[model samples]
Target: MGIVRIGQTEITYDLRRSSTASERRITVTPGHVEVVALTSDDEAEIDAFLTRKRQWLFNALRELETTTAKRAVVLRFMTGSKIPYRGRMARLTVHRHGGPHIEISYRNGFLVDLPSWVGEEDQDAVVSSEIKLWLKRRVRRDVLEIASSYGRRFGLKPRSIRVADMKTGWGACGPAGSILINWTLVFAPKAVLEYVVVHELAHLSVRSHGPDFWMYMAKLMPDFARSKGWLDQNQGSMNADLFTSTRPIIDAT
Candidate 1:
């Protein structure tokens, strides 16, 4: 019975059969809510099942709606906006320079230097790109360092770690040893970033969400709870920044 709903609205789903009955599960992800049916269940039965779980479905959709509304408020880099990078808040200040160089240096705080070669309107784009590139390298280095140290300790090494602008989770590990992390992790604290890395690395040892997985995660990081607390408080803000990236216009001016 493949059926899903967003609040009271029923979502269109393509029903299909699965090999195992236990695999018939419903997932309410930030991307979308989906239901997987394993056997040839009756349409009426499926509808009834969905009806029974309507409250849970409504709640999930409501939460998603709230998240969407909150994310709509973009966190763009203004002249005085305090943006956090690598656990420290950096105040943004624009400087018009003669040379074609967009430099980001910590003076009294984070100063984004924009070349006068670019137009005033284009300053945001230039600054955004420079910040993203700088932060991207920063996050990549930190992830590599943290992942490597843990890999050596836990005897679980990832084939590769990738950082990208993902709208969903902080990090994800596929069946392969490949780890995909959100580059926006640069905006988060060190502990939050490490938690995401550890969470994904643990998937290499335990593929499924079972006792073994939790045990492995605990064995590697004793302060998982604290890490999660930091993530929970910061994840929303981190995710909120992705929306702001679209506001910066990048074009030859």
Candidate 2:
């Protein structure tokens, strides 16, 4: 990691040496900056480049600060704590009983039943795990169902539809026509979820986000713009439940 001082702001960026070309590339994320360049590139030239892009870097860092502030609220896995589910805030109710099994169910609200032996300190971990399990199950059942419906409507048959914990993108369409959607999207509004699903399915025909791709999307879902706009406006909140931490709880494991 390297630090560059631009005016009054200090930017910390990770420098990666790539073997592809002698060109430098900068990627700005919510947390930190990433600079990729060929091993032959001099550090002085890279520092000069970052200095020249000071305005853009400053704007990006400001946006990252705002996003971090919005994600400051921590998820507390206790009773009466509101959890986001299917675009609604559902109250959590944690219950302990004498059993070896832990059951999580959602009816009037969210219910987490744990074994009596589980202590208070372990309750959070247990609840977090149960919530993750419940989310994966819902993604498998509902997201796949919705994606299948849209797929049939668009006459696009993907090789497979899988769900995982994706931080950057809500969904991705692989080159081989497989779709991987983020399970966290289940907390978004139905229309937003539909938009993501349709977006990926449309990629089955059009690979790029060029004008032709959007035109095809218009043909499939006329009001896709509204859904897209909603996501753009509320994306941070939709993802806050999962992505608030500097180190997110959900992982590949």
Candidate 3:
């Protein structure tokens, strides 16, 4: 995989070797690009092909934004909303007067307690707030643990780890040995989250994504590309479900 910056946006694309393909072709998805070319094509040739499609890639990305926005509210704070969390899909069940306080619990699915005092108009906003906070808290703890575990293995320690909202990318390795993981990772599977943590931690050892860097990544996680591709392919839909997941009524009694 390689990254090319057309303007403000950086396109991350994977170059796949094709056996029977006659010519180079580019595929654009939400947050990923794939360059399919003959196996004999060298790195320079692939880069040239990517360069030729730069404008098209830029337009494709812009279209993805518009398309994603159109379906932004696909999932909302209503009953039966599919919640993509921790590598699994769970139905959101909202229980009115389920408890004296707003509580979030996970069994086979997510069970949220919406106190009776809250007005109907405020239900969506309130539930959305509680879940966002819950996800922030959960991501912070998980990131620390994952970073620490991998840090130990690699004999590297990050100065700090924090979960924050990001416009793009899953995690960031700060210049000061700190790591910032996007809280939205709550919507991703554990493996995907772990991959992000490992990615940032690797930055501590190697500052750039060069040969040495990927060598370390492959050593750390053999199937790193799979998780990487998953994150790229699922960039939009997962986050949509997270912020807009509609909830259900559970018997609080």
Q: What is the TM-score of each candidate against the true structure?
A: 0.63, 0.65, 0.65
Tens digits of per-residue lDDT for model 3, 133-154: 8877887888888887887777
Worst 10-residue lDDT window for candidate 2 reads 244-253
How well does model 1 score by local distance difference test?
0.71
Candidate 2 residue-pair clash tally? 0
lDDT of 1 by residue, 1-253 (tens): 3445655577654454556755455545333445656577677766766676677667766666666566533244558766667666777787777877778877656788777788754555667667778778888999999999998888988889988888788889987799999888887778888988999999998998799988888888988879788888767667535525333211110
- Candidate 2's C-alpha runs over 4 A off are 1-70, 240-253
What candidate 1 gets wrong by more than 4 Å, as runs, is 1-78, 240-253
lDDT of 3 at 85: 76
Q: Report the number of the highest-TM-score candidate.
A: 3
Instruction: Show the colliding residue pairs in model 2.
Output: none
